[model samples]
Target: MSSLKHSHLYSYHAANSRLASFAGYDMPLWYKGISNEHMAVRTAAGLFDVSHMGRFSIKGRDANSFIDHMIPTNLVKVADGGAAYSVLCDDNAGIMDDILVYRFSSDDFIIVVNAANIDKDYGWFKQHLDGYQATMIDETQSIALLALQGPKAKAIIQSLTAEDVGNIKRFTHRRVALSGVDALISRTGYTGEDGFEIFVPDCHVSRPLQAEKVWSQILSDFATWGVLPCGLGARDTLRLEAGLCLYGQDIDGSTNPFEANLAWLVHMDKGDFVGRKALMELKDHETRKRIGISMEVGGIPRHGCEVLVKSEYVGRVTSGSFSPLLRKGIAMGYVAERYTGEGTAVEVSIRGKEWPATVKNPPFYDPKLYGWKRVA
Candidate 1:
């Protein structure tokens, strides 16, 4: 069997002219193309096959305590059924990976990590768990994941399942039934929109599901929803607009939460955790800061491009894109503290050309996306 093949949703995406290739699995690039698909989630609704995302379930007597010590967020604050964004950090406080930790019970938790970081993350967990009594299992291959996003997302998903999804608060999850399939429906998404991530077992094949079947059925069911299949391009633009960080781009081993503008996810109040001392030291000592920038001049900025203050090189662009809503090139990067305010004049070097830019607060679009309000 070829290692690279289309996802279960492959034929559905192909019918819509979606570009596809191996992405952990054969995945769609765009169905109606990038522009149209991006606009759909911005204005109405869109569905995504996020089955490629990796999930690990940790369970044992020491699971909760063990995981809390591994990440930089205050896991104690995560209520049962709620999720918290966290960073797995090294001893020096450098990020290993950014992930979502779901506290399902005192002894059970599910961690969702990036697809590319799955093996590495699991390895770290295995090594660290040896001293503790917790058992960590890689459940990535067994679950199908889908994200339904946009202002209409709730309404469309509610019609398919009778799980009282309306009562589920943001970052919280509930067990629901979708077209007779039981699922773990989470009110979470990467698009920065009001959305749900449905985790169904791959074996819900008209019988008790074994988790693996839940993942496959999601990709196989796109035809029933009339959803415009989305690809990585749309995923990037959507997250950028929402001011969410992309791991490899916005954050990495060398990037700290403070420099990535993700310090909110780091809880200094939480008693000693991994990288706590370093993160605390960074907080007390003033240094560089991360900020969002919007180009006044008409042009697209790209990763690794230079951000200049006058004639001096201050920093480099981490992520940039043409804002469909703002109608301008927008970017995020690290700049000196003095140049970190909105309206501060800056320049971005793009392909040997300097483009006029300004420091602005993210997200580039209306902040309403975070509020889940319908765009007018």
Candidate 2:
């Protein structure tokens, strides 16, 4: 709305991408084109400048206590160099922001949050830190993140660092040097395809030139692998195809982890947490379910479209798009619990008409042919 904040690679993006204002930051929507970038990530590889997301460093004597108090997951089991997808919840167990927690040790950790929730999440984090001996530093500006995703993601990083890229298993991270600058490489991505999220941080007070160098080197060195610089448009499509939830759309302030079908991330037996009491009550009391649907015989469903069954309103579409990979309209939305069963008949209202659709568990693209599980 006002002057937009810029990432370190803003200049590069300005020259190469079609820029748009997203989350109060000037970000790329497409480079060559949405379809071109989307297909590249599904087949070969795609690089994304995700520096707009919030990055935080948490460290101190009570770091574990502070974090474990906020999340329902048992942080005790998260080994050093391990990471897990978790959420920040309100007292009522309502979703505030879904986040990724990376554990380096008992007292050192990294938390990555969505771009739009930076200030809100940070303020909440500080309030919760009052009793704990730890400190939370907002490193969103200091760190530059590049998500190199697709089948060939590992090979590109392997060529840069001496570390065994294969050893960094999924949900694990390691310190590696690339383009002569140190970085933290994590084997996690939004795309269902196997890939890595590389974090490049500035050493001195000045802005990080190393971040730009690393970004350049990956594109120049791996031209043969067909690595294209992607934008948020492709990122959204790939994540939806992977069946992953976007914070604001798929899950929001009113959504709980269980209702969003993220029960696996909640550790009820892990002892007390901020929302543990409320979540325990919500466990089996869920009246709504987050369902993925596919449209074979209608126009592309958009957010806010009404979901119906037999002409009765059931819910609304949260995130929807024409799947670039599956070649059909796919979406994720919440509905009355009874209507969420797999293969259940549903219809989405677009404009004034209802389009025939069905509730299907996502990775809307077939797993046997696409995704990390499929043989490349």
Candidate 3:
């Protein structure tokens, strides 16, 4: 078997965690417990070492052009300090990878991609960047990223960063100082909560500013504020509960942007892109579509489980898990476009038995909490 890789924060997890091999990294699945970690973030605050996520920096005179050709988003209009959810597509409009594009300036931008798709996305960027005066840098190793998420995220994060975290609008970013450490703070996250994803230099160990400095400060400030350490397990469930899609599961090479209910990410009016022709044709009508479903049955649905409509195979669950917050199984997947609707009764086949399922409005949790909010 291949040896497991380690993140820059590996030592920290080793000190306190139930480490597991996930996406080839010896990552922490949970430290305390999934429930405890989940509750910690829901009611209080949680810190996550998301360094396993891919970070790519694209810079040049033609950086915008290069990205425009590669992604379906309108890259030119992305104001400095603003961000947008974007996805890479193939010649056929199939999703190559869904990424978060954080624009720092007109010519400088950072993309956060799934950990497993780092090499795949980097390769696609390299091959498709022809003629653009762009330089793509994979800085995954040079950065140690941390996600501070929860109800009290702002109070905890603002205590360390000089830049106003409260003023940073949703889906925007800025360079700021965190406990004297120069960092990039973005009002963004995967979990459905108010949070900041801070980026720190990996090589800088001296706490004139360091990871520990920011960590300790955030912890101390949030002690009464209710902040704790969360792991990948809680992260997964939280995102799932928020009705977010995972790269390999809910979306992949076979899933087109239109079919994945990600049409908002596709900008057909943006002149032309990699899969413009194919995507434009399907823009008016898509045969299959993605939807969120919450199970009312006793059994929990899992990924790859068969989905049935009237006892006939219709689709399969892509991302599924028991939501601790909701006390039921929730999932997202693709099905015949005709079957995508609220209250559409369905069935999920798990193990050897079939269980009842139904389509529900996404974000099993409160929708208002999913967006950014000011601390009261």
Candidate 4:
């Protein structure tokens, strides 16, 4: 068997986590427990090692227009030091992968993409670079990324830096030194919480001990705040509770942004893009809509569970789980447009039994008490 790739912090994960293989990497499913890690992030803080995700730096004279041509989000609207969540699509408007575009300048940008699609996404961008005076560098192997998420995340990060992390604002980043290590710090995260993602170069020779030093230092200092190293299991449930989509499950080449409840990312008036024409034709004509579902007492909704209305087929669950914060079975799925309205009754077929459910808009928790909107 072929060996899986390891992150800079792999040794730490292996020492403390319940290990499993995901996306051809040996990953930690949970440390301590999924529920505890989930709750810690919701109430306190949780640090996640996300170096496996792909980070590509595309920079040169035509970087702006070069990137704007590929995705739906308006690159013009995103200023330097800002990030926009968007998707890469093919000519037919099928999503290649959901990504984050970080514009450092008109001719410089870094894109964070799904780990499993690193090679595919890199090729997608490189093929379009023939005419543009730009270059794309795959930096995934040379960097270590850490996400410190929670209401307490800012405070912990602030103590390590001389700069005011609170002033960084959401969706923006800046060059900062944390624990004496230089890195690009962004106020973004997958968990629906006020957090920061740190990207530092850990090239073994120059920054050999930096990533682990910052990680170990924080857990040591903030142990009383319940800050723990979280694994992928907690990450998944936290994202689902916050109503975020998982690439292969909630979306694929067959799913368009509109049907996936991501129409806001598309900018039709921003001139042309890769999938604009086809997306325009499919706009408002999509037969199904992505919806959130809350299950009854009987079962927990899971991926591929068929959704029904009046015992007839409608859609299928894309992602689901028993929420640790909400204490209920929550899910996100696609359903027929007619049956996608809030409060619409439906059934989720799990193990041959139809469990009662109600259609609702995400997230499955109250925004005022949880997520990035929670009191900070």
| Candidate 3 structure lDDT | 0.83
Candidate 4 local lDDT, 72-186, one digit each (tens): 9888778999998999988889889999998899998999999899999999998888898899999987888889998899999999999988788899999888999988899
In model 3, the Cα lDDT at residue 256 comes to: 89
lDDT, candidate 3, at 323: 87
lDDT of each: 0.77, 0.90, 0.83, 0.90
Candidate 4's TM-score reads: 0.98
Write candidate 1's Cα lDDT for 27-103 as tens digits: 77776677767877776767787767778999989988899989877787788899888889887888889998888
What TM-score does model 2 achieve against the real structure?
0.97
lDDT of 3 by residue, 98-209 (tens): 9999887767878899989999999999998878888999988787788998887888777775666888877888888888888888889988887889888653222223
Which has the higher lDDT value, candidate number 1 or candidate number 4? 4
List the candidates' TM-scores in order: 0.90, 0.97, 0.94, 0.98
Candidate 4, run of 10 with poorest lDDT: 201-210
121-186 in candidate 2: lDDT tens per residue? 999999888878999999988888889999889888898988788999999999998767899999
Q: How many residue pairs clash in each candidate?
A: 11, 0, 0, 0
- Candidate 1's C-alpha runs over 4 A off are 5-25, 202-227, 369-376
Error of 3 at 336 (Å): 1.2
- Runs in model 3 deviating more than 4 A are 202-209, 368-376
Candidate 3: count of backbone clashes, pairs at least 3 residues apart or interchain = 0
